[model samples]
Target: MLRIPAVIAVLGLSALTLAACASSPSSAASTSCERTDSDASVLDFAQASGDFGKPAVTLKAPVYVDSTTYTDTEVGTGRQITSDAQDVVFSIAIANGATGQSLVQAAPPVQPLSSWNSSYQGLVTAMMCATEGTRVVAAIPASELSAAGAQDLGVTDDQSIAVTIDITKVYLAAADGTPQYNDRRGMPSVVLAPGGRPGVIVPDAAAPTELAVEVLKKGDGETIGQGDTARVQYTGVNWSTRKVTDSTWENGASVAVAPGSKLAFAPQLVGATVGSQLLVVVPAGASGAGGDAATVYVVDVLGIDDPAATN
Candidate 1:
């Protein structure tokens, strides 16, 4: 069975280095700016019209300070970010603190919050605990930017980084991989909630005599092989009661799994394709947990993280 902890480590490591901001700074620094408490008035932000994912951002020059600070110009009424691994989608505009000149504007303007490296203290601090639909302005300390990071933004080591982030949506990280589709019958039917959470309706007949696996949706990405890690969203229903006992969707996060791990669903996921949705039925006595009652699971493969390549 695949363990959730192992999967989290793998997926977290793979996504840790993704950067949402553009690679190159927009302008040269004219002077050094001092860091101060977060003051939204000091930085004027003009968001683009149309889709929230592709908002155009305009902000006034901000004064950089020693400490990283942020303010929520608009608070979101949606879900709150509770974990580092929760995928945060937002549009960001980065600028030089000293000159208030634009630095990097993410072209599509939407990316996962975890895409940013943890070394970026300011970015992380600004985003933590923020809810979806919130608009934030953060001032990053110059010390927070590494020499390489400063170079990428075409700023001197002494300059701070200022940014405006428009929170769009937050989603759990999905698992990945790909394979041909397979068709099967007599499996439990599935209905999805508005948020993509699945509702599994088990048949009224007796439980299957053996483990039954069905691929409801096949992905077109990488393949999950032995030792490869996968991130997934899933819900488990006890056959006898037809009640959901466990769910990543309810918890608002995805789980990682590797083949041969302790996770009951690991073996089934080993050969599944990324982006595939699976319905698995484990017979009561066949289940490893002291021959517990049968359980039904609806699994969505979101992404794959190869341990060999990541290590």
Candidate 2:
């Protein structure tokens, strides 16, 4: 969630060799179930050039997009981790001989860089605590599909991905002595104190809730303009009864809150200032709640990724 204007995306565009390898029958046969155990030798051989240290910790069966699994190593080191509530974003590279490396799939902290671009911030939390050579794999489900972590996963509805992370180095201070790469830097924080509320948040602190929102992918040199999409996540609950009426956070559910949907609003919704909480009151009759009254939505703008900006 930290906004690092200086964060650079190095063009590490190697041809997608592994994708090509996966399509080869010979390659497939060579790495099948019969070779699962021996495969580690080959995998290790490919990964040998890299001195990725032992995992500080490992997480098995970490779930990603809907049933997708990261049932392998999800390791990290003290250097790979920070004591911040927000996740840490590491400089990742492929292990020496490994064919491909990916970011684990999950919300914020767990998501790999491949799935987490500037516009999206998947789940955020404490990650692996391993040594320098630690290697981890995580599953990334598209936003529409991570049933429990929809908002944090920040994907377009239903896009699934897998990622592996190998921390190359960790930094403690900036040139000015400030911390440099944790995920929470420069991002907004949730205010749970008296009379304070964020514009958008998990509908239920305990349950999953997804709200449809537009992201500001681009801005005209001036300000937010037409054609710019505003990114947001939301949830709805009955105002009077406080019962959840509907949600976009559920897996396989629609991810758009367009004009005809239960939550309707103007097309000019994008470009709204970040952190401006929105309250949408849906009348009871509008949703056939019988005499149950209406529902309300509280929204908060987490971050904005201007699509038109030159990276």
**TM-scores for all predictions:** 0.49, 0.30
> Residues 117-228, candidate 2, lDDT per residue (tens digit)?
2222221111223333345443434542334333332333545433344544332110111112324222222222221222333233222122233321222222223554
Could you give the C-alpha RMSD of every candidate to the true structure, in order shown? 14.3, 18.3
Best-fitting candidate, scored by lDDT: 1
Tell me how candidate 2 scores on lDDT.
0.30
Residue 288 lDDT, candidate 2, scale 0-100? 25
Candidate 1 C-alpha lDDT tens digits along 1-311: 21122223222433333432323111111122222336555345322233443443344544657777677767787655554444555666666777766665542212345445444556766776777787777777767765555565666766777777777655333322243355555668888653455799888877777898888778775678877877677888988888888876655445567776565677898887776888888888763422367888888876664342221
